[model samples]
Target: ELEHFEMHAEEPSYWPIIAYPKAWSPSAKGTGEVIYLQIYGEEDLEQYKGKLKGKFVLIDTIRNVSPPFEAKASRHDVESLFEMATAGQPTPRPRRRNRAGGFNLNKAIWTMLEEEKPIAVLDRSYKGDLGTVFVSGARTAEGRARDSAKVVIPQATLSVEHFNRIHRMTLKGETVKLSMDLKSSYTNEDGMEHNIIAEIPGTDLKDEVVMFGAHIDSWHTGTGATDNGAGSSVMMEVARILLKTIEETGIQPRRTLRLALWTGEEQGLYGSRNYVGDFFADFGDSGYTPQEMKPENENVSAYYNLDNGTGKIRGVYLQGNDAVRPIFREWLDPFEDMGAQTLTLRNTGGTDHLPFDGVGIPGFQFIQDPMAYFSRTHHSNMDNWDHLSGEDLSQAATIIASFVWNTSQRDEKLPRKKSQEEELEEKREAKKASKAFKAVDPAGSWSYEVEIPGMQVTGDMVIAKNGDKFDLTLTSDYAPDEKEVIEGVQIVDNAMKFDYQSEAQGMLIDIKMNLDFSEKSIEGMMTAGTFGSFPVKGKRNSM
Candidate 1:
């Protein structure tokens, strides 16, 4: 029996409406004259607070849509795949300085909308053209759109063509009127979700496990076919193939094979991260800050993930685990003819496997062919069953199944890179060994001089230790009467980093300081907003 699935707006006699409602948008209906407002800052938002009531407000400018010159779909050629296979460590880019005011325009717009109570808000899709409008969740001033206490107004992303038409009509003094009835509701009010986990018990090494899975959730605009449905389906197919193989051969795997279908990956890998924290490690606050590892950490060999799209498996991204290159190469030898031989030491992010990799377990994501996943389907209304390739998914399942089987049959657990905790301990020991030669502490008042483009300014900084944190205060001689208190200061080894706001010439400036300390002197750079970095040096004051 065919049942109705979730869809956007239904066909009705509404005034020229073809756009879809954003996910998590509340049910609402209204007919009003369209109002175009482009807010840049807080001042602009304040000016339009009382003017937007009961109007369908257009909140963005007309986007430029160029004709597609390049092909919409392509696979990684041999040269590109070879480049990935031979890729070395990526050079770290310089840190970007924060904007002057650090003001968030998008958040401000949503906050103003909530306060002004617009009949409906509309913006053009950030990407795509023709009739494809990429849609995501609604936004609130605070908390997520799904939060029970958060108020989510009716919002929809209009197609670029329609948006531009409306924008042009508004510019010509023509009254453009649109009526929309966005019918939506909250189904999961309790806000509870789960990760589906299952395992095939092993014979001799049942305690040890090899895991494989993908994220099962996707944005609501489409059926989520290419964004993640492809991955979820492939993993499920792998489970069926492995189960049937076991039933036919009567041979049990040496290590337990676990299959996990993770939820909430699109919302920042919450499901996988929580699972890892619960079973393997104690992630104190974030994935990088692991308090301790559980005994179960030793039993997991590796985790394999696939969430790129319907692209066939071209190779594997080693994710900086060089030790597995030879092992994986041997495993891929049979599939080399099928275009799955390359292995790179680089890392691929934005997926569910990251949680396992963060905790030092050997985790891997396959290198798949790029087939319109990013250009047309990913997070867009086109991410449906039609965009998926059956042949590509089959190839992916075959390669992943073999990789999982090979891992389960291995005699030892996959080799691991050094964990952050272990590296920190090593660095601490090295610091202690070298402390006798040059000892320094950053807990004193220091007089510093900074050399800007055309002038030099002197300042006094006072740093005090308050338990585990440090307190910093700065006063420049140029403005001797004013003092700036610095918050969220972090001191690692003999280096200090912090940010603070400074008022100069009636404008608020955001500044960041990175200072390194010697026995009795400090040296580093002070980065002022827009003006760039300046050299800074200081001497410790006598006690």
Candidate 2:
């Protein structure tokens, strides 16, 4: 049962087309010689632009392969889970600035494809080996492929081995001819899709609802079994078990149990966001910023989600809602034997839970074992039923069923975080009650010592005040002649923080410093990303 026959080519035969059901792609059938464009000069692009018409274009360079040396599957250990449970506020990294200047070669190539109208553009997968290709949506020259007005040239991603073979043959001056037919059709022409929602009516609190769901949509490369199909199966199994428990025990929930199978979740959470906007929040022109809260917004207790592959529930990510720590601890107690014990305040993104959490409702996603989800499956051709674990799915369903039951019978709804209006009001009140204070003058030379992993480093930090702003100059003992000047130094109260970037021994170093200022000394920590944090001590030098 093929949804649509994507391609039928020569030796390196089949490759999945990169387009969704609603995205635009041509139903093309053609046979043409494969050509690899090698544009070295401005005139070369023009020469190849005229020759690309009715050809299978090799658009990517050959990929380098590496052996898999590490284990792909892993479970959460005690140390790692403990770190997650006690993690503090994350330090912000400097925003990356694109430094590329001059002619854009990649854009020029795509523009040529759009103009010449090639039979199909071919590229290799970014990751994966041994014929496991990852595939996703298509792209047009100007706008998005999902935009109906954009002209999307046919495109597909091949396995790295096949793509490299074709590329090498062409590089060796051998002609490669390919015959392909892509049979793709568009459905739901009006651009309408739906989400499946069912509910079990509560006995006493019929209006109040407790929801559980998983996105049913996935990438078309494989069956989407591990990425989200596992979650969907677990949710359905939870529903079945709940219905049986109710029938046998003759007990009804205090709040309605609602299950949602959302569509268009892979496409920026369209189904869940729209449902929340329609029922709970009044999203104005931006379609995401909530301008007004509706009446039914208060009825939703929480939304529990599972979509991280077929791994047993280890615990839960609290998503920064500290109020639910004790409540979740009690709920997770019954499942300690099933390995669901840990609880963390860390927030996980990229799922249907985001919409519910965005609008001030409590939304949570469970912590699961990472059994080859990122290494092999997860939107790749290997994300099929064969990779799913039945035992893991069963454990997840049992834990989720108990969680939903406990939520349904709670005396009150789960506590919510501070809303935008409440937070804004607090800021206003605090501002009105505060007095102005100036930072202590740190405008002199200081002797600095940083205890890094291997050794202690000594440096001199000179801060010079120019009217209203201060500039920092640092000279390390390791590089006495190389003085690094840093700008945008921020000093608030008795603390100072800044990021210093430098090059040492052919490697780039980025160190973030958080220093506490005193009358005669400074103490702090310098955190180099991935290299971990180190202690720093400094003494003010007598002028």
Candidate 3:
């Protein structure tokens, strides 16, 4: 599991060197224990062997912050959020889930590259808070943003106070004797970011594709041990096992299997999204609107994303696809003993798969135990090689490998639910015809025609105008305004809660339940919202 991007924790190291004239003078050879070298190009690290020369370069930029492990472990914020989501009583909390305010490290470097076009970057990872420097970004709400971040950038490091000596010396009358020893860095894996990609070609349906991925890039601060360092390794391991097993078993997938180790995942799912967008666009996914992107090819299977912190696999999120339950049930049969057995039809987001789901493509994010990830490691200073769990990772890799294998070998493609955006628009249009749609209460005097799920999450809500009354009946779960108690309306607040209710006034009879009103939320504080009914029975005279 730790084999892909092998975790390496770098112990603290302190080194020293001296500067020289033209960086070659013998007098300056042993002058000092510390040397401040300036880089001259995107690939050149200015290294002087003996003396001082041209420009005195400012070098190093890195930060380190520790984790409040004990404090975080006691807090169950994440636990509450996940549990509430699974039970369908979505939280009312406003979660930002945003990265630190931007334009700092990534931007400053990119901007400097754009303007100065330096040979290379000099960076020093900060260990504690005493040595501090804050950088800002180039964007605000008003300006037209620049889009020059097209490639992966490179970086190097030095000590802050040691490097500052050159800055002070050059500012004085001293022409700061400095030298740079630069080597060609962009020659190999040391320079550019590589996305490891592999694919299992489909046999029966060769046109379809099922992609799986995780980011591989991490801050140089601590070898990126966690905070996605583990994610990258896990995905690789998953790929390895699946490929090996497929080869050993001689099993060919029905859909193409592509695995990608994304770049700039920490910055955002840049690599994965760009890849998906470009791939689908090239093959014509045909996303005319921002919400719906269906390729002309029906063979394209769903995309599976695994990016939760490294913990034992608990279950796989369905991403609101109730239709996927049976399929997942079948696929999970093999790994039921591994403990990844639960499948909930709840929507979970915040990762690469979000982009796909936003565009109407079926995407799934697996649920995993967080373990001590949030409390102690993750992106903190403590996140190092030793933070990873072998057994947990192995368990995860096994499940993911099997999942990818099964998905790739599926005979038909996964189905995508209607985009929420389109559904919302349809709902808005349905409201205009107030008189056309009516709500009839089954208990009051309405007739029952069909049966549906015990809890109706949502559906068409129509209240028809009939003189003094509103005729209403829902095709799904429903609730009405309880406090005001409209002349003929029934409210389903905690005290007067009712899962099933019917209303009939003269010939019109209808039965419906409010989608928002659930038996689960019997104690929580809730504010009132407007309600609607549908006209079913002959209640035209009663209205």
lDDT values of the candidates?
0.76, 0.75, 0.45
TM-score ranking, high to low: 1, 2, 3
Clashes per prediction?
0, 0, 71
lDDT of 2 at 392: 95
Model 3 residue 391 distance off true place after TM-score fit, in angstroms: 0.7
Candidate 3, 378: how far from true, in Å? Answer: 2.9
lDDT, candidate 3, 372-395, per-residue tens: 564455444456788677887898
Model 3, global lDDT: 0.45
Candidate that beats the other on lDDT, 2 or 3, i.e. the better one:
2
Give the candidates in order of lDDT, highest first. 1, 2, 3
After superposing all C-alphas onto the true structure, candidate 3 shows an RMSD in angstroms of 18.3
- Lowest summed lDDT across 10 adjacent residues in model 1 is found at 1-10
In terms of lDDT, the poorest run of 10 residues in model 3 is 20-29
Task: Give the Cα error of residue 541 in candidate 3, in Å.
Answer: 39
- Candidate 1 residue lDDT tens string, 1-543: 012222222222233645777777777676677888865556777778788888888877888989989987889998988888888632101222232221345557778889888878887776788778777666666566766767877777888888887888888877766767666666666777899999999989889999999999888878899979999999999998899889999988999999999998876677888899899999876344458999999999999999989999998877667889899999999997788988987666668777887778898889998898887888888999999999999999999999998899989999997643354345445755784635456778999998652257898988887666667778887656456666445566676777765644223445767776777888766655433345578999953
TM-scores, all candidates, are 0.76, 0.74, 0.49
